[model samples]
Target: MSDIISVGFIEAESDATKCFRQLQYQNCPRPGAEVEIIQLAFIILGLEWNVVDVEKEYGIPPDMGTQINSTHWTGMMGLLSEEKITMVLAIYKIFLDITPERMKSVLFAFPSRYFQTIYVVRKPNETVSQNFIMNAFPSTVWIILAATFMIIWLIHILHAIIFCPKDSSIKKVFYQESGKSLMQLISANLRQTSELNSTGSLFVLNFLYLLAMIVILTYYQTAMFSNLVAPSYYKIPFRNRNELSARLLEGKVFMTDIKRRRPYCAYQCGDLYKALEKNPMKVRNTDAEVFRDISNNGVFQSKLDVNFIPSQFNWFSKRYDKIIIKDNLEVTHYTAFAFAKSQRKLRKKFDQALLKLLPAVEQITTAHGYRTRRRPFNPIQERHFFALSIREHFFQVFLIYIIGISLAFIIFLVEIFVYSKTFKNIATFLRLKT
Candidate 1:
C-alpha cells in the first residue's frame, strides 16, 4: 500500500483530493465526475493508499521553505524534503515558493487549475458634507448662478421703471422691493410659480435664466444622484496600492497579515511585503480573526482595512458584502502537487496518470467550487444594495417630505393666529361704533 498524505491547509482540499475521492467511491466514473488526484494517481498505478493530514497534526498550513541558503524547512514541504511522506495531497502554488532550495527538495507534478490573489477592502462610504446642497456645485458655478438671478431681478426693475405709466405714482413704479424680487427670481429658477410677469428686456432675461436654470439643475441633480449612489473617485481614499500606501503613511488605513506571510508574499508583492513584515501589529493569526476585526472596526470607525485573499465564490458569504474585491489587482498563480525529490520516478508516473485524468480533475474542481470566481469592483454590490431594505433607498426623499409638511403646518398655525387677532379687532371696532 502506498502512503498518500492528506495535506490541505485551508478549509477545503485542492481539486486533486476531490478527484481521488470520486474514484474511490465509484468504479465507473460519470461524465465530468470529480476525482482526488494523489489517491487516484496511485490507484491507477495499481497501488493501495493510506491518508494522513499534516495540517491536522501541526495546526498550520504547509510552507515551502525560503531560499537555497536557508537552514530550516518546515510543514508539508519539510516532510517531503526528508522523504517522510509519499506525497503532499494538496500543496498549492501559494504555499510553495519556487526557489532553488525548494526545487532541489521537492518535485512538483500534476499542474492544476489557476487561481488569483486579490486585495479586499471596505467600500468607501459617501460622507456628505454639512452644506451638501451648496457644496454640490463649485464656488464659480454658484457665483454665476447667483449673478444670473440678480441680473434677471435688475432687468425686471429697469423695465418696470422705464415703461411705467405717466399717470402712475412713484411708489407704484420705483418701489421695487429687492428682497421680494430676489425671492421671486429664485422661485422661477426652481420651476415654481412666481410673480415675475414682464415683457421686452425682462422677457429676454427670463428666457435666458430659464435656459441657464435647465442646465444648472440638470448638472446639479446628476451630481447629487452620483454622489448618493457611490462615493466619487477622488473621495474614495484608496483604490490601488499607491493610494493605499499613501493612506497608510497618514495613518488612515492598514493592511492585514493575510498576504504578509512569507510563503504567500514571494517576489510578487515586493515592497508591500517588506512593509507588512516590519509592522507586527497588523498580524491576525487566522482568517476568522482577521475578518472579525475588520467587521468590528468597520461598524464603529471609518478606518478602511486592506486584506489579501484568494478569489473564490464562497467569499460572498457572511459579512463579506461590505468588503470590496478588486479585480484589477488580481494576481494569477497556478497550483500543483509537491513530491519528494527521491520520488522522481513516482512523480513521472503520477504525472502521466494525472494528465489522462485531467478532464475528470477539472470537473471535480468545478463541482467542488475550486474555480476562480470574482465579484467585479462594483460600488452597488460592495455597498450591498440588494441586501438593504427599501426604506434606505427613499430615506432622503421621505425626510424632505416630512420637513416640508412640518413647515406647512407651522405656517398654517401662524396664519390662524394672525387672522383671529384681526377678526377680534374688527368686532371690537364695530361694537364701539354701535
Candidate 2:
C-alpha cells in the first residue's frame, strides 16, 4: 500500500463564513474549484491523502513573496521548501507572477484552469435632473438642433430687413423686427399661426422652417417619451486602467485581497499602480471585510469603491446586484498546482493525473456556476423593468414639468411688468387721487 501523502491546502478566507463549506470531502454541499480538483487528483493517483491548513499551521501567508529574490520563503512556499508538506494542493500559480525565484523554488504542475483579473466597479447613480431635457437627445443632435434654430432665426431677420417698407438702420431693423421674427418662429414651432406676412423667398423659407420644425419636434417628442418610460442606463464609469485611475482620484477606493495585492501593484510604476499603493486600508485583511465593502455599494464616504479581483470570484459581483464588472483591463493567467522543487518525480506523476482530470474539472466548475463565458455587466437594474416606481422612474420628467411651469409663471410676471398699460393707468389714477 502506498504511504498516505500529507497534502497541505490553503483555505480561502472568503469561504470561511460561506454556508457551503470549502475543502470538504464527504457530503459537502458545495466543494469549490480547488477542493474539486484536489479530490479528482487523489482519486486518479489511487492514494490516501491528509489535508493540512498551511496558513493556520504556519504563520506565513499563501502569498509567496512580493520581491523577486528572497533568502527565506514564507507561507505555503516556506512549508513546501522545507518539505514539511509532500505537496501544497491548489497553490494558484496565477495569483503570484511566475518569477525566476518562484520557478526555482517550486515545481509548477500542468495548468489546471485559466483565470483573469476583473475590475468590479459600482454603477454610477449621480445624474443631473436639469439635464433631463438635454439628455433626451445626444450632444451632437442637440448641437445640430441649436445650430438649425440659429440659422432659421438669422434668415428670418435678414429677410425682414431686405423686405422692410421704410428705410431703417441696422440697429432699428434688429430691434423692431427681431422680436417679431423670434415670436413668429416660437409660434410656428408650437403649431400656433405665425404672424409672418411674406411674399416670395421669405414665404418659401417660412414654409421650409415650419416643415423642419415638424420633423425635429416629431423626433424630439418620441425620444422624450421613450426617456420617460425606459430605464435610465448610465455609462460605465471606467473600462480601462486610465479611466480607473481617474475614478480613484475622485475618491473611489480600489479593493483587492491582501494576499494578491502585491502582485497586482508589483509593477511599482504607472498611475494605476501608484493609486493602488496610496490606499493601504483598501487592502482588506479579512474576507468578511471585503464582502461587506462589496455588498454595501462600496460607499466609502459617499464614493463607490472599485474592486480588482480574479474572475473566479465573479459570482460575488453577481451576488451583490449593485456591483458591475469591466473585463477590459483583464490580465489572463494559466494557474497550476505548486510542489516543492525536491518532489520532481511526484510533480510529474501529479501533472499526468491533472491532465486527464482537467476536462472533468471544467465540467465541475461549470456545474458550480463558473462558466467559460462570463455574464455581461448591465447598469440597468432588473427591478427597473418589472417594478415601475413613479418616484424612481418619473422624478426627472416631473422635475422638468415643474421647471416649465415655473418658467411660464416667471414669464407671465415679466409680461405684467413690461407691457401692462392697465397697471400704469391704475398707478396714474392713484397718484392723481393722492
Compared with the true structure, what per-residue lDDT tens digits does model 2 show for residues 354-394? 88887776576555643333444455543234443467656
Clash counts for the predictions, in order: 8, 0
Which candidate ranks first by TM-score, i.e. highest? 2
Model 1: per-residue Cα lDDT over 6-44, one tens digit each = 333322434444443344356423212222455566668
True lDDT of residue 380, candidate 2: 56
Instruction: Go through the candidates in order and give the C-alpha RMSD of each one to the true structure.
Output: 8.7, 6.5
Q: Using Cα atoms with residue i matched to residue i, what is each candidate's TM-score against the true structure?
A: 0.58, 0.69
lDDT of 2: 0.61
Stretches off by above 4 angstroms in model 2 are 1-4, 11-36, 47-71, 90-99, 120-132, 138-180, 229-231, 252-263, 266-269, 276-328, 365-377, 380-434
Per-residue lDDT for 247 in model 1?
57
Predictions in order: lDDT: 0.54, 0.61
Best by lDDT: 2
